[model samples]
Target chain A: MRLAQLSERSGVSAATIKYYLREGLLPPGRQVNATTAEYDEEHLRRLRLVRAMIQVGRIPVATVREVLGHVDDDSLGRTIRVGAALWALPQVPEPDEDDAYVRAAHREADALLDTLGWENARQLTTISPAYRRLVVALAAFRRLGYDWDAELLVTRARLMHQAAVADLDFLETQPSEEEKVEAAVASAVLVEPMLQALHRLAQEEESARRYGFE
Target chain B: MRLAQLSERSGVSAATIKYYLREGLLPPGRQVNATTAEYDEEHLRRLRLVRAMIQVGRIPVATVREVLGHVDDDSLGRTIRVGAALWALPQVPEPDEDDAYVRAAHREADALLDTLGWENARQLTTISPAYRRLVVALAAFRRLGYDWDAELLVTRARLMHQAAVADLDFLETQPSEEEKVEAAVASAVLVEPMLQALHRLAQEEESARRYGFE
Candidate 1:
């Protein structure tokens, strides 16, 4: 196929595809002749993955390049190689160290990990956007005078971990490494808003029962 | 309390507080004199709620006012009024109707709710940001060539619903309507990124085990 077909098939514009090829986010297709290039199935597949990261995951192009590079690297184990893409995803700003609420929230986040017995996961905690987000949310709760109790936070996390396990099982069911990596990112970027939405719907259910609107 | 006192205690600058007052997001303080007005605890609480909606919830001021108005309306039952705020949150663009994939995804989303037995919650699904987000995500998966089996989507949604129930339980524990509404928005907006972060961390744990790194 050519650039025109790639754009038509992938739903990405020909010009944007050109930009990606120039930036090395997508490898160059085979040069058929002067002023013409041919793309293989691999190129088509790679184009889709790139679009997923940008469109669904909302990762920056620079970060997407790094993530794809990490995915392509063979030095690491297959799981770690693909998981590296996650480490490269954007992270949150560190909360102020001097703020007492932040300090307490940090301690609570650590303790919640301990309670969940996520020892190995904890090793990645310090580097994870998830951990920072939790700490930040906990602190924000306190700042707003709602002191999210430690017990409640832990309970919520346990449920989240269960969901994560289910997600991993589904990702493992994918047949290819490329698909697996795409699925992992897809699940992460896509399932997030879905979870939030389901939450609101569930809340509506709970609220109906509690207030007798059902 | 004076504006400075309110600022000092609330940690919002006086200028910002004045802006909130001028915007009618905050109720006017008691008029002690032409030079000074005294604010009560209610003003402080309302100010905090407004800030939560703006800074944490990222809701535009106009929308925030509408949400707060719904929250304050007495005719609606407690759960319905508070939950109304969620319906006002930002939603995703509706997927193209003529797209076969989108039409398929819409039916699947409907079935997902049916499978979960979320009968009452389904009423609010069309109006909810969560529903649109899920539909868009499901359609994207198809557009990208991932089938996202009906069983799998429903399974993922069940886990999400459980977590949501827990969230609603937590919200119910709050002591007042203002606090309840603020906590509802806080949980939705703040916990979202936290959930995404957790999913990534969980994937790490799963990858370690699957690849024999653990």
Candidate 2:
């Protein structure tokens, strides 16, 4: 296929696709002539992945390059390839440990991770941003006078475990390696706001249910 | 309580608490002497709220003022007070209408809202930030070649509905109005990271289970 066909098929603009090529986000096509290059299904697949990372995931161009580097590195196992990309995404700045609440949270987080036997998951490469974020969030809750006991935290984790497995089940159905990786990345990034929106909407629905607004 | 006492009790420094007083994030304390002021439980409560907004929720000072203004207003009903703050939280920039994918997302979002009977929730004062986020995310997913059909979206919503209701039940257990409001805000803000972290951890666990890593 030609560039125009790829652009039309992908619903991305020609100039944008050209820019991606220049930026190495998308690989150059087979050179058929001086001004024209031929693209194949593989190029199309990669272009879609690039588009997902940039437009949907909102990953910085440089970060996308780094994440894609992880995706393309075959020396890593499949789980690490996916997990490493997730690990490489942006993270929150470390919270100040001067506060007692934050210090307590670290202890509580260690207990919770121990309860779940997730210590390996925490140190998979460096520490998972999720663990750091969890600790920060737990401390914040404690500071706000609403302590989330380990029982509550574990319950929430179990609920999310099912949702995550359900989502991964969907990704496993993708037909190609690139497609699976693209789907996993896109699902992880794109599904977040959807989940958040659902929570808010559900809250609204519940409020209405309780207050006769429905 | 004096400034020093307030600092000791809240774990917020006297200097920072004074800054909040000057910035109107906290109300003025009673001047008990030429060089000292007397704070009360109200001040302590407000201090916790302000700290939660800044430290845990990461709300900007100006936005916290706006949200707190809504919270302090007696004219608005409780639902709108909380709902309005949720509505006022930041939003994703509107997607490009020139792209067919985004246009399709707008249509799909509308259809999903209709399916859920949430049009009123979308326009509570103005379009809810969550609603706007949902649309942007939907467009992004469509661009990534994953159309979230209405059935799937509804299923996700039901799951979140249960979780939101459970959290609200905890909020209802608070014994005072201000504390209830503070806990509501903090839970809504702080719990998101916990939920997100849980999702990621769950994903890790599921991957381990499937691939024999656990």
The runs of at least 3 residues in candidate 1 whose Cα sits more than 4 Å from the true structure, single-residue gaps closed, are: A1-5, A30-38, A212-214, B212-214
Q: Lowest summed lDDT over 10 consecutive residues: which window, candidate 1 chain B?
A: B205-214
The residue-by-residue lDDT of candidate 1 on B173-194, one tens digit each, is 8888667766776666667766
Please report the candidate that would top DockQ against the real structure.
1
Q: Write the per-residue lDDT of candidate 2 for residues A1-214, one digit (tens) a residue.
A: 9999999888889999999899887888999999999999887777877787777667899998887888777776667777778877777778687988778888887787778776555554135677777777887778766555567677667667768777778778788766676667767777888998778777766665665331
| lDDT tens digits by residue: candidate 2, B121-199 | 5444145666667777787777765554557676667678778777777767878755666666766777888999888
Interface RMSD of 1: 2.5
**Model 2 DockQ (Cα-based):** 0.50
Interface RMSD of each: 2.5, 2.8
* Model 1 lDDT per residue over A1-214, tens place: 9999988888789999999999898999899999999998778778777777788878899998888888777677766766677667776778887999899888877888788787766777666666777788777767766556678666666667777778778877888867677677656666676676666667777677677561
Give Cα distance to truth, residue A198, candidate 1, Å: 2.1
- How far residue A16's Cα lies from its native spot in candidate 1, in Å, is 3.7
Worst 10-residue stretch by lDDT in candidate 1 chain A? Answer: A205-214
